[model samples]
Target chain A: MVERWPIVGMGAICSLGSTARETFDALCAGRSGLAPIRGFTTDWYTSDSLFEIDDRDDSKDRPGRATGFLLSVIAEALTDAGLSDDLGDVPVLVGTGLRELRSVELWRGSGAAVTPAELHFGAAVRSRFGAWDTHTFSNACSASLYALSLATDLLSAGEADTVVVAGTDSITESMFGVADRVQSIPPDAVRPFDRERRGTILGEGAAAVVLRREPGTGGSPRGWVRGVEVNCDAHHPTAPEAGSIAGAMRAAHQRAGVTPADIDLVMLHGTGTIANDLGEALAMREVYGEDLARPVCTAMKSMTGHTSGASGLHSLITALQSMDAGRVVPVPTLEKPIDEMSGFRLAREQAVPVDARLAQINAFGFGGINAVTVVEGNR
Target chain B: MSEQLFVTGIGVALPGADHRDAVLDPQVPEPVDPAARIGRKGLRYKDRATQLALVAAYEALRDAGLLSDPDDAKSHVAVDASSVAVIAASNYGNLDSVAATIDTIQQDRSTRLVSPINTPNLSSNVIASEAAIRYGLRGPNLTVCNGSTGGLDALRWAGSLLRAGRAEHVLVVAVEPDNDVVRSFAGTPRALDGAVAMVLGPARDEVDTKRPPQAVLSATQRAATIDDLLPRLGVDLTAVDGWYGPGGAAEHGLIGQVRPIELGHDWGTPSSVLGLLQCVHAAARFAAGATGTLLAVCGDPADGVYCGTLVEAPRQASRALTAAGHDAHR
Candidate 1:
């Protein structure tokens, strides 16, 4: 059987909240963080709505907004894990879609004196936290989950006692422009699985989880990462294929040593786009068939917006908090659910009370990269 | 440590080198177009890095006897399509595409004029995904854009996938293009414009009598420093037949006792392709009938260091040399 890695500490900063606890509470209360783009002028694009954090750190030493978010979340995670900020030899694996691309754009747009060394976060991470080593994965939206998979492998292979897996992305003009052009009319709010959903709004934030070989001395583990499986569709660049996604989900379940019946909750990668929602729904049907209603489903994007690369860990932290509170957060903006997800019991309108334990989180990215993670929450 | 991984095939698309035998050439040659080496039928939308990676992957697969033609849609391989994986490492693979998109947006003040073909190229994983799609490699595909240690980390990830039974064969490719954007990001006047690919798989007992592995990867480890990593491998570096590492290792006093063979000295400072280039050079040395083991160390001080030990395959060293088309005298 595959060994399970314990998630000892987690920290998240997104539109909903600045901390994981605050985000979970906002999610339960069905608060929406989507608003007009404040970080940059979105006058060039028709779609101005985005989930952006309000906290600003304009220090001269700060490389960029994305790096600031990443460092803040990592510090929170380390502190929550009862570890010193000076990570002696722990390997930090970061997943980012567009690392410092926004900073580059800013530099090019307005002669900002951003150094080339700030392009990659290795130097920033080393200087701030004194990390021993760092590696960054840019697997699109599913980047962090891939980092999580690698961290689990490190623990299973006895490579490290603890590994920090983080995902961060700030909305870039390039990506936002692409998203704006792709959709005929960009929607004001993210509405996952809704029939009227036009497209997903871009969001910015960072999320991190600390995985340990054993329970750390700081605190008990939030949950155990039972298994994670990653695969490629090799079909299309932006469009997702259902067959490969279903295969990844099955592989993750097999690795986790769990059956469809044991899962109590599922965090869908519901980007609310016509292609993404329909593809994810088709993949779920292929996995569960008639038993899809067994696990309560929720789409965190409706509240947190599409966090992109950080969405997987954002969903993961939300799932753990749901299990703790015995309530599944609702997809607040989900109304007139799509016909494809008719049989699935999606949490909508209000939070659902349940004794959830085993939960699965799905993160699909551009280039047909897909990652599925199964975690077992502590009761 | 990995469970006896083997290097079965090697391919390169370096500036000065065209074939595996010339990968370690000291003289720099004129720049060659990747589309010229590989066919240009489907190379219109692909960026330079992706094209280079595709060329290298095609050669590597053909070298491994898994593919016959790059244009053939039905080339047969020994393993299943779903059992092969692709892992790529590049720090600036998508720089050109991203810069083009951003520049277009900035110039037009809108995204309506952005080319649809170039939109997907903005994704960093597109290089690896394109390789997988071209070859129908459906297993775990990943792209490493980390700092200096990305190449070695890609190798480590391939080992993990193989040991965990996720893939029967893995095509590990590392490419860095020499473009203005790349050079700007690298903070150098000139940067490495090359790609290297190696097909790695588990070393099975029932090896084909006719074809043998080029080398056996005994172990790979990473640590803050060479001093902290050496004891973990439990191998005597002094006894190894060859040592390949960065030039900075000599200053750190890690390689004072041993003569380190530094590859890519003239290629400029490579970001993530240095480690894979080192491996390709070592494989060529092994195929040329070098004895004992060779160590390839890669990484910078900030990202730490990674060391991988490659031992010559004992029984099939002679046959492997013939299979790789290496001149035994060279």
Candidate 2:
């Protein structure tokens, strides 16, 4: 049997909060991290509001920002899990869905005293975290979850007893310029699934999870990553392919030994972009078919914006909060649901109370990359 | 361990090589026109890296019977498009496009000059994404940047996905475009830039027209060093037929010790996949009944470990098929 991976600890740093718990609480309270860019600026396109990780010194270089963000969350996760033993040999996998901000910065820097390793952001992270052996996944927004998938494979295959799966990316001037050029940034707020939704606001953040090899479940309930399914569109570079998205959902459910009817809630890749909303809604329908018993859905992108590579973990942690609170958090400004949203309940305005047992965190990105991870809560 | 895998087909688009007729000069690096070989439609906007990967991926697919002809690609796919996975591996990424866009903006001082369509090109995964789109491979599309072994690890990743029943077949492609800027930035001596692709299938299958396979692969794992990497094959390399090294500055003395049959003479981590092409080419030269094993190692300091795969030729692939058929008949 494939070994089940138990979630021992979780940590995150984003504009929503510096800690995962804080981020969860803020989302539950309907707080949005959208604001004018503070730490980063661009000349060609400067006014794009973003969910910037405030509080870090503005003058800090690119590597400093990214490294500090990653280490802070990893420390929190390790502490939360009570794993104090040496982690020198533990298998490590870090993912950056997009290009590493530091690599972009170093390349776009003044080109002085830049070491060769600095050009490879994965090496810098390895050096700082002392994870001499780590695999880096760079599959766009689904990167961290892919990293999670790799870690799960390691644990299931008995290659490692413990594994650290982490992801981090800070918005850079270049990133901002690209978003602005592509017109992906919203003019106002990120209103996912709303008729008035414009687009998503790019954000900066990091997330890490400590996964221990376990059979099914025999430990204190931190959480359970039952399984994750990944697939690609083979359709478009930027467009979300509902067929593959549906394929991933079906694969994840099949691997988790659960039927579509077993899903209690869904945290979608609701980037507030109409294309993504329509695509995801269609995929959900494809998975659930015409079943009357459909799961309620929520999106933290309304609160935390699009954290890019770190968005999947943010949604996972947020769902964990809902499981603990016994309420599905609502998306702000979701006054009118889009026409494509059907077969599932949309959580908006106020949090909805429900006894949810299984939840799926969805992350989709450029290259038609789709990832669906099933998590078991203490419901 | 899950079911064994066979290297059913390989596609290579190296600097002085082409997989069309299997001509490999292995000379100094030079630019190759992917558009010329693969056609120019829909490729005008892509980077050299993406184009190179697409060419290699198509060749590999054709070699594996997934594509019937080079002239008619979309109509010729023989495998289930929905059940095929694609994994693109690279270490340097598409620096050629990044540098080009940055240089253009610097020169023009206007972001307007850069096409908005190019925004997606900033990602390293774009190479794999393009391959999937062009080839209609909807299975687990992955992009790996694990230093030297990213290429092999991609093969390993595909193997695991296949074992888990995620896909029926997997296409693994690795590409590195020659960038003078990156070469000078690293102060490396070589201009190694090319792409290599492989199509892997289950060992127990009698689905295709070709022989079992050129080689069968063991599980891919991370080893401490070159010493640990090769021995994991459960045999001595001196007794084996050959070795292939895509090691960078981190693994200096490894080549002199292993004495590879065909020295890749390539630098950088992505070239490890190119080394794979070299190894496969040499193994194909073996007499039909000849038996041998080739150890392919790719490592870099950034990766901090060697990732190797053990390939057994005149491989035990037939044994796996026979056992499966025996069970079926019994």
Candidate 3:
């Protein structure tokens, strides 16, 4: 097994509050981040109840775009982690589902100037933290976790003692248009694992986590990355083979040196799309078997709507906070859970009482890319 | 646990031909004549990224003596795919979709040009996924996009997996297509199209018969800046046999007489893969006693240069030795 790497700090932004504490409180109160479609028109759109940022101030000198939103949230996350914007010494690994939609729009509109990578991450580091080593990761949904895993490698390999892993994606017209086409976004209400669930609502936000080899005397160790494993179906560009989903989970557990029994709960990617939900359920069943009393499964999509690349961290942040608070988050909108998938425990509105310390967060995306990260409270 | 991750086999498909051998000994495939690989039937439809990766993945597996049948690649995992995350690192995700959408939008009309291919392909991760599908890799399919460092970055990521006990075998593939957008950004005549892949696994006492030879990865370190690595690497520039770098008069005096072989000259844009191809070439040459210790430096005029070296051992040494008359000082 690879040496166990530690997660020294974390940052997150979603429909919830800008701070980790605020977001955690909102989650405990079961506050959903979903709302009516305002980012774009939904007159004929089939989905509703997307995770939208409320009271988003567009008055800043920042241009009105997805990037602006990302920068704002990243700023808030950096503050929480007690880090500057510069990432020179530390590798600044940024993840996003849709990278620079503004660049895409400009390229489409007037063939205008495109933003350089420096302008994005490079400039962000220079302007915010002062100086830093940086790189951008655009792997669809699993991008952030990939960044986290890389951070683990850097620390484990002694490349850097500390690394800043951040994930950000903005909601733009092009983003919605694509979401509309895929039918992954729902018209209203974010409901995951609901028998009548339709699809996910695209949400905009950024999340950051400061990973260090040694967590100085400060910081909470509620949720540390035990092991991270990534896999592809090698089958299709957009869909994952059912068996490989399980393979990915197995690999994560193997790397983390833990088992399904060691897991206390699981944060499902739960895109709210039928295929995604079913696929996740099948993977859980494959790994946990018919033991319905096994690891409790919950999802954050209802609370955060689909954050895309940031979804993994969104779930991770919630798991970390919930673990510290000594509670299990309910599967927010599971009106009627599927019966055919007759294994695994499902969380209700109130936190499920449990003593198990381990948790698993599953993030899968287009091109059949899958990553599973194991987390446990600091011993 | 930090054993050598050997390069058992290699596969390469360049401008002129496809082979399971290294091309370094003969000299960079004389800049593709008409660049025959460029506008071919299926090749035209593929984005430069896909084409570069396809060629390299196919060739790398072939070189490792494993591509004859689909089954040989089954246990392999894509180490680069997980580098960034998932679908975001796709070639279809970035170039094709954005380019098409941009083209359609410039018309002043609100035209929609979204396709599934765009989302999966433009993404930086697509190269890794495509490699997995092509080779049927079941273990650790991942991708990493760190710019100029991507090629070696992919190699290092695979090497880590081997060191950490993640997989028994891993496929490390790096391919960059020379898209018009990327080329214009680089402000160059476009690099050659190519792909380079290496099968990395732990060093073994006995060749398990189930696996290939073990090429140990001694060590790799990135400098805080270019200067920090130069003198520390023990590189004796004066004793060098060849200098493989960019083409054109602009880069002429950058390194004297070494005659920079523009692998991109014939290939156009996807030259990153050529770096690996160059490594294989050096390996073959060293094996043939034609040259010794080859230095491959790659970078855009804008960004600083990044160097990759292939140190040949014993009989497998590059042809540089015999070619340079085994001169201690040339």
Candidate 4:
């Protein structure tokens, strides 16, 4: 057997809560982070509703909202991993889908407090995590999922023994403009799997995790990242492909050396948009086939909203928390599940307890990027 | 463990009004001609960076015998691009479109004026995925935004794909388009418009295979200092036939005291790819003999993290991929 890459520590700062525990607890209780947009003001329609982090601190040292959020999670993740102040050889991989636009916004006055003329999203993370080296992935929303996979490859390929995979993005005016032009943002509550769901509610958050090659005994790990698979549909830059999405999911399970039957939980990349919900649900049914012994499925975007690059990591950590609690957190506002998702055992308000050993999280992005990662429970 | 990447094909497009393959000074700003691949008609509305990447990708694919000439039946390889993965490296993406979209937003105070096509180019992954969409590559399409060291980073990720058996060949391409917006705000004075493409495949051990390989590449290795990297590649620091570098980067400590020689032309914006392209061009430099070894090293000025690749031309001795260490770190 090869070296096991167990996630020794996890930290997250999203609209739901400031820490992993708070977010997990809130999500399990069916709480939502969606609210009126804060911080940066925009002239677009998205100003009415966004899952923006509450910017309580006006510190001059904070580079940008996203960078500040990223540092907080990385610090907590390092501390949680027991490495604390000793990050000697560990490489840092960051996936920020909107880093370019975010950097531009930072220069445009919102981040005037940020010092140093040239502030980089990934480089800022390097100093915070004490990483000797870093890698940046900007594959739109599927970025951090690719980062996690790259980290696993780094570990398995013997590049490094441990790695910190983290990602962060902030709702910016430019992105809001893009969304406004496309008219992809919902006017009401962000709802996934709901027949009346309009579109995605853009969100911002940061998540960090330290992965070790061997199972850690010093602290409680969220889960073990078994395998990650990524591919492109080559169909449309914006549209999701059902066949390719199913192919990515099956590939992940196959690489993890497991069958669909072995998966206990499936966290979807449900963006609440009509197209995404339908496409992802159809892909799920294709992967699991017609077997009634299907895995429990849920989508966290109903609460967290679409976290962009951080969505996949958030889903993985959320699944691990539910697995630790021996339950599955229901997808909030999932009334009137889509036709394609009706065949699966979709989670609703109540927490359904199950002996979930393996959990799979799927993330799809623009540019036809599709990523699926399988993680094993700490148990 | 990492495996060696056999270099089967290489293509490069240099900046200037003409967009030549070999440019003495590529610092001039000019978009590459889409030429016959997409033709002028297809790329009329496409951004400069996308057009450059498309052209380079087509050239590399053709050089690797993955694409057949419509007129020549004997040149037909009939290779399926769906099985080939793509890894693209870039620092700024299409800043031109990003600037236009942002400018339109400020000018009109509404996004309605921005073209739908220009908005998506803000994401750098569009540069990589656009090529995948055009070529029908179903494998992993990765985009790295690590500035100067991006080309090496893409090669490292490509090596990992080979080791994992995820793909048989990966088209590693890097393109930097002239963005007046970037020049005005971002202080990259040396930035130029250019695109480089290379095809990496599973390291071949057969010397007399059906196709003669351009070069055999060792797994890309990362080093804080040149001393650490040379030992891993099992080569003495000064033993290589030549070294290719961009400007004074080779002398910059991480690569040790090697002369900062510009092998052919190092005027490209993404200097790392320029260095790799220079190394590939050095294959023809050794006219006295058909055999030589060259080491290409590049360092990101932001951080001194160094990544180097050892290229053996018309080979002789070789070391296993696992023995030669490599890292795709930022």
Index of the highest-DockQ prediction: 4
lDDT (CA) per prediction: 0.79, 0.71, 0.59, 0.72
Q: Estimate each model's TM-score.
A: 0.92, 0.89, 0.80, 0.90
- Per-residue error for A171 in candidate 3, Å, reads 4.0
Give the per-residue lDDT of model 3 (tens digit) for A132-251.
355566667887887777778767766567777777776644555556656744346667777888777788677777777876576664457787887777787776667888888888
Chain B TM (all candidates) = 0.87, 0.82, 0.67, 0.82
Error of 3 at A231 (Å): 2.1
Q: What is the lDDT of residue A347 in candidate 3?
A: 80
Ranking by TM-score: 1, 4, 2, 3
lDDT of 3 at A89: 51
Residue-level lDDT of model 4, residues A40-140, one tens digit each, is: 44454434677878775642213366778778888888888887755655778888777645556445433343322223454565455555467777888
- Report lDDT (Cα) of residue B112, candidate 3: 42
lDDT of 4 by residue, B1-330 (tens): 335677776766655422223443444444555664456644656677778887777767666767657233123235655568889876655666666766677777767676776656767688788888777778888887765567777888888887767788888888777666555555656565767788887544374466556777776665555555576555555546666653433444334434444544435355435545654555444322556566776665455456677776655665333344433332
Whole-structure CA lDDT of model 2: 0.71
lDDT of 1 at B315: 47
In the predicted model 4, the residue pairs found to clash are A134-B330, B220-B326
Q: What TM-score, to 2 decimals, does candidate 3 have?
A: 0.80
* Second chain TM-score for model 4: 0.82
